[model samples]
Target: MQRFTARAVVVGDRAGTVVPDAVLDVDDGEIRWVGPAADAAPAPDAETVDLPGVLLPGLVNTHSHAPMVLFRGQAEGLPLDRWLGEVIWPREARLTGDDVEVAMTAASAEMLRNGVTTSVEMYFSPERIAAAVTATGARAVIATPLIPLPGMPPLEEQLQHSVELAAGTPTGGTVEYGLGPHAAYTLPLSILTSAAAAAREHNLLLHLHVAETATEGDELLARHGLSVPTLLAAHDVLGGRVLAAHCVHMDDADLELWQEYDVAVAHCPASNAKLASGVMRLREMLDRGIRVGLGTDGPASNDGLDLLADARLAAQLARLREADPTALTAAEAFWLATGAAADAIGRPDLGRLTRGRQADLVHVDTRDLRFEPVGDKEDLLTHLVWSGITPLVRDTWVAGRQVVRDGVCTTVDAEALRADVAERAARLAHGG
Candidate 1:
């Protein structure tokens, strides 16, 4: 058992409560208690660590391709279609299992140092990805990509592999698996419908990209005589549990369909803007009572995995799109990265500092000028959302295990990992 005393604790619950002079107790990888330090009375033999900073739930990234760290900064200014077809897909075709393992290892370390404890990963090589996550001690929900490509197995074979992975990795642990159908543009209607049926049969989360850009919607509508969402509805693909990413081009009808189907949206504001995709209708989504959460998309697209910066960008974009200063509050943005993200991914046991929740927390050093003039508990969250950076994270823990301390990752050899990735990335860049 262990107890941590901090200056403040941002309990990322539904009400967004904050406790000052907080004490958090952890036992067997679960939070045992959370309250004011003055009221805590631990056993005599328990260990205690006093910290001079604000404690908050570690950020949850609702969508990402973790192994894309090797492709970061490649195809710099290209839009989504050219970027994927010309740069990304060609290189990804040559990726091996070891390549995915090393890249995801570095990505896990980077995310942990930035205070993101849990991430939803959609990529190939699920077993290798899971091995990397296990080695780094990071929590993840990995979804196998279900797109058919040349020189690859048939669609049925791919689906069977995904189901096997999901069955082997059940929920309630540090890792989970799901089905990821790339998108309507890349996959046919039969494949999409079959994937949805498999997901329903296995009771797994169906994650995919949808309505990412105007070009995508235009192409789909021109070919199918219906919008992307409407086409999905016609095939009965939207009736199951879904986590749709990059919903930047959704219309009112699409929004209504998503709401009726109770689909969750993973809003990747930074990636969307970087790729020249329009901003999502965040205020409208919230107003319609739709579930929306924050995502970093991928290191290649966003060029960074900082969820705090992504939160700030989301708030700014929401305000600009709505032409209202109060379109999205800092607290609301913070919630998108934490509690709401967990909900979007269907992980109720994470993204909060409360009894029975996982002991995944981050300690932010508030002694710097970035957090100057700290007024109240509310101000802490505002500062974290607007001014927080990777350097502010002093310590990070996942499931009662301290993965990072004093701004260093304990589970990964970052220096060696970076060197290896540099060589591998160069080879991939040269079309080896």
Candidate 2:
């Protein structure tokens, strides 16, 4: 058992600063108590911490490539199509399992240091990624990449591996398993059918990149004579409660298809804007009451795995999309990153500071350069979303364990991870 207290904590919305000096007790990897410090009875056997910051629920990243940390800043300034065909896929074809482990380890560490507790990742060699997640103590929904490129093996090989990893790790892990079928044009109809069937049997979420760019949408329509959603629905893969990465190029029909089939969207604004894929009418999705969550896409695409930064960028982009300063408020963006995202991903108990939920939380210091002049709780939240510079995340906890403290990675040798990334980059640079 362990116990701690935050001087001031944000308990979701409308319950601002409920616990001025709040106590949080963790027992056997669960939060047993969370209330005022004066009301909490002392547990003599428990280790105690005194958090000198504002405590809030940890952020949930809906979509990312955790191993792409190795490729961060290496691929940039190109649209999603050229970026993938020219830079990403070529390097991806050469990566080994060991390379994946090193990269995911460093990525997971960076995510934890910035207060992200759960990640939904899709990439190659996810077994190595699962191992890194296990060692890092972060939660993740890890999906195997099913690229339909030439010389690639059949889906069954990766299918077997994904099943094995999922069965082995459900909880107490850095990641579990899910289905990732790359995208529409890349994966044939037969492969989509197989993935959909596997997803149904396994009861896992199928994550795919669809309508990410106008060119992709145009090509798919030219070849198949159907929109991305229509083609997938015909193949019996669009529905079944899946996570679609980008709906930027989607039409009213495609949007209506999501409403009928109940699909969640992972809006990656930074990635979309950086690649000039065009904004995906984020406000339009919200207005339709569609399930929308924030995603950093991949570190290579976004240049980092910082969820707060993503939330802030999401807010800014929403305002840009609507041409209104108050398009997406700070609290609303916060919900998108936290509770809304958790609910979108089927984790209702997550993204809120309450009893019986997963003991995943972040502590942010208000005494920082970015958070000065915090007048009200809403203002504090505004700072969190709009002005959180350099991460006030002094500590990050996942499943009742302090995985990162004082902005340092507890489970990983940060310096060694840095060196390992350098080595991988060198080897890949020289084609060794």
Candidate 3:
């Protein structure tokens, strides 16, 4: 057993408790106890480590295309359709399994060093991505992209492969598998329904894009005589566990359908804003009791995989859209990147620092000038969300194992991975 005492521990519980001089006890990769240090009783054999900083639940990135780090900053300033069809897809066709592993390795290290331990990834080459996740000691829920394009396998074949992958996922590992049908505009009704059915059969989350752009919803409405959400519901595609990403163009009716289907939203505010996509109705979504989590999207689009930055952007965008500073509080925004994100992805054991939960946490060094004059709990939370603290993540722990220490990733050689990705990214960019 190991015991860690920190200056302050942000519980990230149901009540969003913050305890000063907190002690957290971990055994077998699970939290055994969490409370004030004055009340903690140390076991004879417990190894105690005292840290100087505030401890927080490791950030949960609800949506990402980790392998797309290879394509980061390639199609800058383009709309979503042109960006994907004209720039991304053509280059992605040349991606090999080894390229994906290299890109994901860099991405995993970057996220871990930035205090994100759990991520929901949607990409191709699931096995390689899973291998990269394991190598980096980062927990991930990987969804194999089921988009049927030229040079790609057939939809049925991919669906079957996804099922096999999900079934073959090792038990109690740091990775899980799911089915990802690209989106309504990219896939047919039959493909979407088939993916949903497969997800139900395998008991996997159906992760996909939904109502991302006005053009996507308009095209779906013109073709199907229904909105994207309604069409999905009519075809029984939303009947199972679903994580819809980039729900920026949804309406009241779409929100109603999502609520009825119990679908969670992965709000990628940074990517949306960068692509000139409209802001999501976050205030309305939360008011309607919808589950909303922060996502960094893909590095190719968002240009970074920092969930803390995304949380601040989400809150700012929500307030700007609603014209109310009180639309989303800092604590609430922080929750979107932590506990609420885990809940959105259907993992209750993650994203919180409490007993019986997975001991995935981060320690941020507050001695920096960014956190100067840190006051009470509310002030600290505000500083964390509003101030730039990404570089202050001194350490990150996932499942009771230290993946990052002193702002450096221990599970992977970051410099070597970056050097490898640079060559691959250049080749992919030049169409070599």
Candidate 4:
């Protein structure tokens, strides 16, 4: 049992601001109490940490490939398809379980240091990914990598392998499993049907890359005489349960389909912009009451898997698209990254600091010169959003355990991970 009292906290809300003299209490990894500091009833012998600056729920990266940090900035100037074929796919084929564990540990270490506690991971070797996340005590949704290319194993075999991998994982504390069916372009109709059936059988949410590029949408349209969303709907894949990443090229009909299916969107603005993928209709989606969360697609495309930077980019892109300053307010941007993201991953128990929720949080040291006065609600949020306080986060915690302390990771050695990353990345760069 422990109690933490902070001078102020940006409580997750639609109101879009902070609260002064906030107090938060945790027990067995869940928030037992929370309120104004003056009104807090804390135990005398309970361990307490005085966070005088600011405490907020840890940010969630709704989409990522954890071990792909080994490929960051490798194919710098290529588009999504060319980049994947020329550099990403070839390197991924060479990875072993040991390599995945090492690289994912490195990537997870980076996210912890950057105040991301819950991540949505889609990659190869999900067993290793789950192991690293469980050992580290962070939260994640590890989707089994589902490929539909030629010369591949049967769909049943793939599902069985995924079930086997999931069975070995005891991530019940903070990890969940989902189906990762690469995309509509790569997966055949039969394979997709099988994947959807597996997802329904397990009652798991489906995470997929959809309408990521113009070319992808075009190919699906020509082959099926319909959009990807239509195909998915026909196959019963898009329900209130799907987390669709990078829906950048959806038409109005597709948007209607998303609303009908109750699908959530993981908007990766930085990656979309960098890859020359068109900007998503986020404002329109939100207007239609579609759930949307923020994601830093991957380190290779975004060049940084940081959700604060992602939030900043989301707001900036909205403003750029609408040519209006009031496009996405700071509070809304924060929600998209944290609370909304948690909802997208089907973890409503997270994303807030209210009583009875998980104690996944980050403490930001606001005594720095950037935030002159942060006690008030709007000013604190303005400073946090507009003044660039994301880089000033000092610590992060997930499941009531400290993962990053004093801006450093407590689980993995950063220096060692960096050395391993450098060595592996060098080999890939030289095509050895």
Candidate 5:
């Protein structure tokens, strides 16, 4: 058992609770107790560690392709279509399993240093991705992507592989498994239905991209006279544990469908702006009682794995879209990356620092100049959302294990990983 005393603990509940002078006790990778320091029970057999800063729940990335770190900054200034068709897919065709493992290891370390303890990953080579997550001592929900790329196995085979992976990986572990259908337009309606059915049978998450660009669903609408959401609903693909990413082009009926079906959205504000994909209806989604969480999308699209930066951008865009200063509050933004993100991905055991939850927490150095003038607990949350504190994350723990200390990852050699990725990325970029 371990006991951590902090100046303040951000409980990361829906109410934005903050306890000053708090103590948190961990046992067997789970939070045994958390409360004000004065109210904590005495623990004679626990190791004590005092943190001189604020303790908060580790940020959760609701959606991402971490191994895409290999393509970061490689296809800039291109729209989503050209970006994937011209550069990303072509280069991804050359990826080896070892390359995926190395890239994911480095990316996982980067995420951990940024105070992100868990992410929902959708990419190829699930085994390699899981290996990287284990190596870094981070948590991940791996959704094996089912895409119809050239020279790949049949769609049926891809679905079977995802099922097997999910069946083998037990529920409630550091690594969860899911099925990721690329998109509605990318696959046949039959395959989407089958995949959703399989995911439900295995009690796994069904993640996919949807309505990212204004024209992304044009072909489907022209062919079936229905929007992506409507088509999905008609085919019974919207009812499962579905997580739709980049819902920037949804309308009233589409939003209603999401609420009715209880589908969650992975709102990637940074990547949407970077690719000119437009902004999601964040205010509308929240007002309509839809579950929405912030995501970094992928290293290539977001260009980084900093979830706090995305929270800031999400607030800014919501305000700009609604033309109101209070369109989205700082507390709401922060929740999207923490508690709300966990709910969006159906992982209730993560993203909170309460009793019975996993002990995934981050230490934020309040000595930084940007955190000054915190007059109250709400003010502290405001600073966290708007003041760019990603670099101020001094330490991080995942599942009661300290993975990052003093802003450096403790589980892997970051320098060597960076060098290895550079060489591999160069080869991939040049097609050597």
Candidate 6:
């Protein structure tokens, strides 16, 4: 057992509760108790550690292709379609399992150092991705990629393999499995339904891209005369743990479909803006009770893996879209990266400082120059979302085990991983 007392503990609940002088107790990789120190029970047998800063639930990245870090800052000044069709796909075609493992190891270490403990990963090489996350002591939900590209197996074979992977993974563990159909435009309706059915059978998450750009679904719409969301509904693929990424071009009817089917959205503001994709109707979605979480997309697209930066960008874009500064408050923005994000991903065990939740915690050093004049609880939470505090993440813990300390990953060698990723990325860039 371990007891950690911090200057402030951000509960990360929907209400954005913050406790001053709080105590968080952990046992067997789960939170045993968390509340004000005055209301805690005595646990003399537990090792005690005092944190001289704010403690928050580790941020949840609802969508990511982390291994794409190998292509970060490449193919710049290109739109989404040209970017993928011209550069990304060709480079990805040459990816080996070892390349994926090494890249994911480095990416996992980068995210952990930035206080992202768990991420929803959709990339090739599921076993290698799992091995990388496990090696770094980080948590991940590996959504098996089911894209219909050249040199890849048929959709039926891919679906069967996804089912096998999900069936083999233990539920509610550090590593989970899901189904990631690349997108509606890239796949057929029959295959989409089949993938959703397989996900339902195994009780796994169904993640996919939907309506990212204005014309991504034009061909499908021309053929079926229905929007992507409605076509998905017609084929019975709307419900059952579906998580749609980049819902930047959705309309009222599409939003209605999401509400009706209880589908969640993974909003990637940074990537959307970078690719010239229009802003999502965040206020409208939230008003209609749609579960929305922030995502960094791929490291190559967003050019970084900082979920806090995405959270801040999400708030900024929402406010600009609504033409109201108060459209999304700082507290709400932070929640989108933490507790609400966990809910969007359907992981109730993460993203909270309550009893029975996984002890994935982040320590933000308040002594940093950026965090000044700690006025009140609201101010603290506001600073967390609004300020440039990514570099202030001093330590991080996943399931009660410290993985990052003093802004460094304790589980992985940062220097060696950087050198290895650079070499592999150079070879990949040259089409090898």
Residue by residue across 264-376, what tens digits does model 2's lDDT show? 99988888888888788777777787888888899888887887888888888889878999788777788887877887677776777777878888888777778778665
Residue 378 Cα positional deviation in candidate 5, in Å, after optimal superposition: 1.9
Candidate 2 total steric clashes? 1
Worst 10 residues of 3 by lDDT: 11-20
Which segments of candidate 1 are over 4 A away from where they belong?
none
In candidate 2, what residue range of length 10 has the lowest lDDT sum? 10-19
Give the residue spans of candidate 2 off by over 4 A: 12-20, 36-46, 167-174
Compared with the true structure, model 4 gives a TM-score of: 0.96
lDDT pick, better of 4 and 6: 6
Runs off by more than 4 Å, candidate 5: none
Residue pairs whose backbone atoms clash in candidate 2:
133-174
Best by lDDT: 5
Choose 2 or 5, whichever is better by lDDT: 5
Question: What does the lDDT read for residue 352 in candidate 6?
Answer: 85
Model 3 residue 251 distance off true place after TM-score fit, in angstroms: 1.1
CA lDDT, every prediction? 0.90, 0.80, 0.90, 0.83, 0.93, 0.93
RMSD of each: 1.2, 2.2, 1.0, 1.7, 0.8, 0.8
Count of backbone clashes for each model? 0, 1, 0, 0, 0, 0
Model 1 per-residue lDDT tens digits across residues 1-432 = 999999999987646688999999999989999999889885677788788998989899999997999999999999999999999999999898899999999999999999999999999888888899898889988889988777678888888889888987756878899999999998888888998988888888899999898888777788889999899989989866799998998889999999999899999999999999999999999889888889999999999999999999999999999999899998888889998888888888988888999999999988989888778778888888888555889999999899999999999899999998998898898999
TM-score per model over all chains? 0.98, 0.93, 0.98, 0.96, 0.99, 0.99
Tens digits of per-residue lDDT, candidate 6, 1-432, equal 999999999988767899999999999999999889999999989999899999999899999999999999998999999999999999999999999999999999999999999999999999999999999999998899999888999989988988898898887678999999988899888999999988888788999999999999999989999999999999988788999999999989999999999999999999999999889999999999999888899999999999999989999999999999999988889999999899999999988889999999999989977778788877888889888899999999999999999999999899999999999999999976
Question: By TM-score, is 2 or 6 better?
Answer: 6
| TM-score, candidate number 3 | 0.98
Model with the higher lDDT, candidate 1 or 5: 5
